[model samples]
Target: MKPGFWIAPEGAEEPVNIFPIGEEALDASHKGLTASGALAKLASLDSEALARSCPRAVELLSTIAAAIGAQTAGAPTQLFRLEGLNDLERRLIDDVLGEGEVAGVVALPDGTLAQIQESVLAGIWRVRLEADERHDYVEIGAVPEIVSRAAADLTASDIAIGPVPEGTMNALPVLAEIRERALSWRPGQRSQTINFTLLPMSPADMGFLQQTLGNGPIQLMSRGYGTCRVLATGIRHVWSVQFFNAMDTIILDTLEVGGVPVVALAAAEDFEDSAERLTQIIEAYFT
Candidate 1:
């Protein structure tokens, strides 16, 4: 992964709080059985147990099928919960689907631990919640709803300026513009991302900008070529997004004033293709 402003703290030796799903997490676990072994076990299940397992698998498979078949083409974002399935069954399902590029385990303010994993099928995500009863869901979209929903909610009243150091002239204008854009945003509106990188600003200007915006609670990391770090600045709707190269050098630096960045968003076509891909997966097991 490339390293830059996105992957690490600027001018700092160590990364702040980046939770990257490592290779170990992405590697399929064949502790006692392989994916095919699980499939064979599933196929040999007796009628009553199959009634329990197959229904859940088929329900998920059906959603994947419909998602591919155009039946859900125009449907609103869908979240399907797999009720009454044990962890083993769920693990089997995951093994069948395989793992995708990114996965994350986030702890929300309300103390809910939400784990989100992109399926091998791109836009399709497997979201799991660790509560009294496990809640497992399959979601297809740009990013999971939990991420956007968990972002810090900011309002005008929440904006307060602190004393700035001497010679910090350029930051005020940029800060004001960001404040205005952030305050005007409404939920469900199209994402409005402002690229601060295009502007010619000095290090002092950038420093002042970060100091003024403050820091928010949420910190997210996604990996592709290198890594991209998305930080929720203390102010509402304002996010510090940075992309890094494999060398850990910051390649692109910008502030996004919306839900999430497009780079982190899965293109709609991904979900469309995921449906057909999932169908083939299910067929392979049955065959």
Candidate 2:
């Protein structure tokens, strides 16, 4: 007769604990004279006796594998027991196991069986598998570092500064400059008219401008660029303004109306201390 084991899905009401194999089952499985019977003989022995019988242990493992295969129809399974191997042995088992959820037995450390089960349910022992050609097996370990690096890179890359430019200009001149730039960037296309607004400069205004320029919608204004309204206040508010760029792409589009580009370079004042950090931030987005 083929040897076999049983499995039960975890249940909410069921007591959370590791159950060990009973002596009777062990004895029955290990009891004959042939090589297959070695497991039974080993079961009759105490841990010390079994420890001395390496050949018997090996045979027993084979028998258990056969029994599990015959019983489980090749499905993954794990055997849980309350007193078996030490921590090193458990780590070794995890290291050697194949990919795809191989089923096996776990002999929990005596008094901590219940706690261990709870930990397992909480995913404390989860391991990832890596491809290996030698043994046609996968080595299990912690999550790879590349995944985390990729996520961080993507987040840093997505950050952007503006649809709003640094300086402010009049509605008409800014719009005209933007259109001119756009035409220069992509010739033969007619410039589109963009609406502009002028508002008073205040802390709240600064905050709103920061938000709108930092992360806002302006893609509707131009195909490759976004549009933003600038608030020009104070003395510089009266002059006509023009934006200079390499490709003539109208990055900033708004006419120089009745305001000045609020020049508060206070944030960028500590050049030595902040230059490198700002450079890194800017480079992260562009590169």
Candidate 3:
């Protein structure tokens, strides 16, 4: 026979009370009921019945009641009470208990619901901390001209723009260059779609890009690599460019559709030389 199951002998024992679940056993049973559906059913019961039926359930109910009492005394709702709840259970309480003026129920930090009613009452509003509000806001900036032009030519919406740092003058040049390219673009391609790529030459460049972009959905292709797509909101220029570097092939493909200039950078050790190479490439595309 199973450990918890037993058969009764013919009047030999007190009808063998098989699996007499004790307080500890009942506590174990309550573990499964900690979920939203199970808790909801418990919440539907009266206080006396709840307390008499499941001690664990009573504990949860009493917690909610105490929280309500504290709130009524003008205290902040305690969010730490729900420590081990799963995400689904938390969300369930947030939806059902927190909706439309239910002050008796509250959501804890880990996303569990606690009912805090001293006397069964309705019309309460549980406070919830929105997910987006918990984090700091970081801004991102526009894509570089070289990348933007390439993206525009390819009709790609997703493109990446830089590692430009905050409070730097670096993004200005890139933005200006893109604008210039846009102005020089052919009239027939004025309404063309554009995308952007930013190659952050420095950490400062990355910071600048973040500040400029400002919480938009910039696709992070890899560490230090990002992409952004341009909307068809009145385009100014359209052209294509190619890079000889195999690493730059994607950008080249993105920009190759329109008749732009293929820019080449000479291999060098100095940053100035690299910048100059990029400038030459931009100039070639424009001229």
Candidate 4:
């Protein structure tokens, strides 16, 4: 809703590349389905037969179409439960909701893991909670509840002010600033960022800050005009938001204190395009 959320972040205008430029990275960075890619992937499969068999899956897609039309991103998610679906029904849901740009995982306190990914349609997310049991659902919103909820669950109310270790210099004030902002930040408050890349940080100071605000389980990557990785840290409401160039160099590294980084979430304006594309796919095949 603010000015800087949707605009491309400050960086090179090249497309985002998640993996490094190596043989192993190439193997790991396999591309997901595109519009044409989806067609190729399903060329042999009978669309009408699958759709006819999975009525509930079709209904789920229709529901997503309607909810996305509302354009209420950043609000409470509109969830469509996927439990009790037979194997065929599951295939129908999985095939149509191809992967989008953003991907994330949040480990819950109960030790269960919530895998979150945006669908090919923006503002539509696929959340799977897995561990002892598996639960799948489609959450229509800007970002999944698991992500925002995990941020709220951070223990940042009062960080443990430990003694400064050997070689520690200049990290005290940084931590203090972080702690003060974290304590005062509310859900709707404007986000505050301390750009470490712009500031001066020595080896020892950087090490101390990293260890103090360790990385948390929730990590989100937005593959837009360059990669923007949003990682929640051990400190409450504090996050490490790093922007990378096409060559995978860390162009900007900052610690944001407040809510999850807006770059990782789809903006309200993305809803119409997503709805139209999904509705087209449904009418073409799922109908």
Model 1, 1-287: lDDT tens per residue?
32222333558565544333343432332133333554556566553554455666656666666764453423455677767777756665666565565665555666666767776666777787766344778776677778766674434225566777676656777778787878787656666665655666666666667667766655555665567767777777777887777886677778877766666666767666777766775665533
Regions of model 4 farther than 4 Å from truth: 1-31, 42-44, 132-134
Cα lDDT tens digits for candidate 4, 1-287: 11111122248463222222222322232266645666556556887887778898888888889888886765688888888788888777767877777876777888766877787777888888765324788888879888888877876566776777787667889889998998898878889999877676666676677767765768677776787778788877888888878876678878898888888888888888889888888888866
lDDT of 3 by residue, 71-183 (tens): 32112223323444445434333322322110112223344322221101221222222352231111011111222333344332222454544555455665555455555
Q: Which pairs clash in model 4?
A: 156-236
TM-score-sorted candidate list, best first = 4, 1, 3, 2
lDDT of 2 by residue, 1-287 (tens): 11001112236332111233332322232122322232233335453433333333333333333332232211222232212444433332222111111111222123211100001111111222223112111111111122112212222212122454444433234434433443243212332333222322333333333332222110000011222222211111121122214553333333332212211111122222222332332233212
Q: What Cα-based lDDT does every candidate model obtain? A: 0.62, 0.24, 0.29, 0.74
TM-score of 3: 0.19
When sorted by lDDT, best at the front, the candidate numbers are 4, 1, 3, 2
TM agreement with the true structure for every prediction: 0.73, 0.16, 0.19, 0.84
Cα error of candidate 3 at position 56, Å: 2.8
Query: Which window of ten consecutive residues has the lowest lDDT sum in model 4?
Result: 1-10
User: What is the C-alpha local distance difference test score of candidate 2?
Assistant: 0.24
- Sequence-dependent TM-score of model 1: 0.73
